[model samples]
Target chain A: MKETITLKIKDLFEDIGNQATFVGSFFRNIFRNGFEWNELIRQCYLIGLKSLNIVLITGFVLGFVLTLQSLPTLQQFGAEGYVPNMVSISIFREIGPVITSLICAGKIASGIGAELGSMKVTEQIDAMDVSGANPIQYLVVTRILACTFMVPLLVLFADAVSLLGGYVGTSTAGGMTAALYFSKSFSSLVFSDFFPAFIKSIFFGFTIGFVGCYKGFKANKGTESVGIAANSAVVAASVWIIILDAVAVQLTSIFVYNQ
Target chain B: MENVIEIENLKKSFNGSEVLKGISLTVKKGENLVVLGKSGQGKSVTIQCVVGMIEPDEGSIKVLNKEINELDEQELKDIRGRIGFLFQHAALYDSMTVRENLAFPLKRVLKVKDEAEIEQRSVEALEAVGLADAIDKMPSDLSGGQRKRMGLARTLIVKPEIILYDEPTTGLDTITSKEISRLILSIREKYKASSIIITHDMSCARITADRIVIMNDGKCIAEGTYEQLENSSDTFINSFFKI
Candidate 1:
């Protein structure tokens, strides 16, 4: 048992070494092959445009629920009119980026993982290498670049939709006027609230694409490895997003508070 | 005959479980060399090392007169243009139509910008492999044999100087195996490419090999013409051929 544990550790180290080497090679190929603009556009369409409805629906629902749930507490304070401001701040700074990223982690991360995992399992990756194609540039770069660009667009869309949902929820449940609620919401949101969340999302996008591509590209063993790679891709990306978000929030609070 | 590929003292290990250990071999240009080995005897690793896919810990691999181990990424990419590999399983991209699969490397690697030229070459390759009608079909729509043929079409589309076959007959019916063997020979004749075929299928080795190399325990145990191997008195060789 002890020997088995030691062997496992050794294996893990070797895998880490291989992954480091591959990442270096992956970046090298990305630069060597330059960029494929059409492929980037296609991936943006797939990752961003195709995923808009889910992000919109989920964000709207989340905003509506948060407003509805906050009504009772704000009513107790006799500051129910402040509900929009609170919901807006929460959504813009924390809920919006975090929730949207979790959704994307599930959607885009799994898609990238499964696509590349299947490619690996099928040996299309090997075929690419043999055909003098840099599979990393052709596969991983398109994906990572797509996620980097698309996630920001998706988050921007989601934030807008969610704020609109907040407006509807406050007017209906809290008996606040739509114009007054939106005015309050906008007044409460400064550049500080918006920029930090937006910046964190780029990290979220990078994390999702990086972990997903890493899992899938390094997949080996057989068909079952594809499933494992996809699952771990989602899990790891989601967890990293949350961890990074916390750190970003802390850093933002420090800088903003002093200013 | 000038050597197209040369390996000297190759060694590789995954987690200390060595796959290829101090192995050496060479293949001449235009020669079809069949590497016969059991399933886990490092045959695939040997070929992968030659292509610089799995880097060996020790020793040297020279392909087309260039040291593969020392080449930079761009250099490797340039070297790769001259070699082709037909995977054991067809390995066709599930999302791509057969035509796209054949054209992918042409456009991506070869930087062939003209759509008409890409299409023409794709069709020619498909025609060569008897897969012209399957061009628009997805890989998932093809039969196993058809998938393998499409894989061959994709490999041939590049017009490589060297072709590597990994278990070309492993999953095919005998009839399909014969067809694949014929395809291999036809590819050789058409391109005059140096070929390295790895398989345990004795019939495949017999039909495709100009010279047969037998690997055991990560080492080249014996090598000769197919008839020479078949007639050898060595116990392992005798048992291998079952004659």
Candidate 2:
């Protein structure tokens, strides 16, 4: 048992090292000549456009539930009018970006993992390599960049959707007008709240892309490895997303909120 | 004839088991040299080492006069650019259509930016393999023979000086296999590219081999012309012919 535990820890550290090297290769390939612009555009469309529906639905439901849950508590303090301010701040500062990122971690990461894994198993990657084409430049760098660019945009869109949901939640009881709700939502949300969340969502996106690509790129030669790669990509990306969120929150509290 | 590939005492191992044990071989310019062996005998490993895909544990591999193991990444890419490898399963990029697949190596490796030239070359390559009508279809839509032909087309598009085929007719019907074997001979005549074909198919060897190397237990056990090996009095080599 002790030896097994030690070997597991060694494997964990080795995997982290391998991932660091992969990310380094990604940066190097980004600056290489003949960057694959067309592939990047296609990946962006696939990752961003295909994920929009889920982001919208989830964001709206989250805001609606938060508003409904917080209403009675705020009513006890006769602070019902502050519901918009609370919901808006919560959605923008934490909930919107985190939830959307987790959803993308589930959807986009697994899709990339499975696709690349199958390609690896089928010898397509080997074919590309032997043909003198840069697989890292064409495959890994494009998908990661697309995810990094698209996730923030998705979060911003989700933020707006959630605000609309919050308004609907407010109307379920005796409520303010749309104009008043919009005004209240923006009144308390300063630049600091929005900027930090946007920045962290970008990191979350990178994590999702990096973990997925790394897993898929290093997939072993088998049909079983494809499923393993996809499942592990989601699990690893989600864990990284949560860890990054915690770190971002702590850093934001120290630097932005304190001042 | 000038040798396009020269391997001396090549050796390779995986997980403590040696796959290629000091295997030595060569392919002459414009000759179809077939490496015949059963599975796991490192026939594929030999050509893979020649292409710099798998590094041999020992021995020197010289492809077109450059040492494969000694080349840097850029130099290796340069060497690889002049070599076409057709994997066993055809290894088509499933994401792209047949035309796109042929155009890919041309665009990326050859840097052919002219769209018209790309289209012409892609169409010509497909036509050569009798797959021109399959241009717009995806790889998954192709039949087994069509996929292999499409794979050959993609390899031919770059106009490499050397082609390596790994089990090109493993999973095809006998008629399709014969067709592919004939295509291999025609490709050599038309393109003037030397080839190292890895296979266990006796019919494929009889049809295409200008010279044949038989490998067993990770070593080259016999080398001769098809008729010479076929008429050999040695029991082991005669056993291969009997099959």
lDDT of each: 0.87, 0.94
Candidate 2: list runs displaced more than 4 Å.
none
- The digit string of per-residue lDDT tens for model 2 on A1-259 reads 9999999999999988998899899999999999999999999999999999999999999888999999999999999999999999999999999999999999999999999999999999999999998899999999999999999999999999999999999998778899999999999899998999999999999988888898898889999999999999999999999999999999999999883
Q: Which regions in candidate 1 have their CA more than 4 angstroms from the true location? A: A1-30
- Per-residue error for A171 in candidate 1, Å, reads 3.2
User: What is candidate 1's lDDT per residue for A55-91, written digit by digit as tens?
Assistant: 9999999888888899889899998888888988999
* Local accuracy of candidate 1 as per-residue lDDT tens digits, B1-243: 899999899998988898888888999989999998777999999998888888899999999999998999779989888898888897887888888888888987788889999999999998998888988999989988998899888888889999989999888899999899989999999988999999888888888999998988988989999999999999888777883
For all the predictions, what are the DockQ values?
0.70, 0.89
Q: Which residue pairs collide in model 1, if any?
A: none
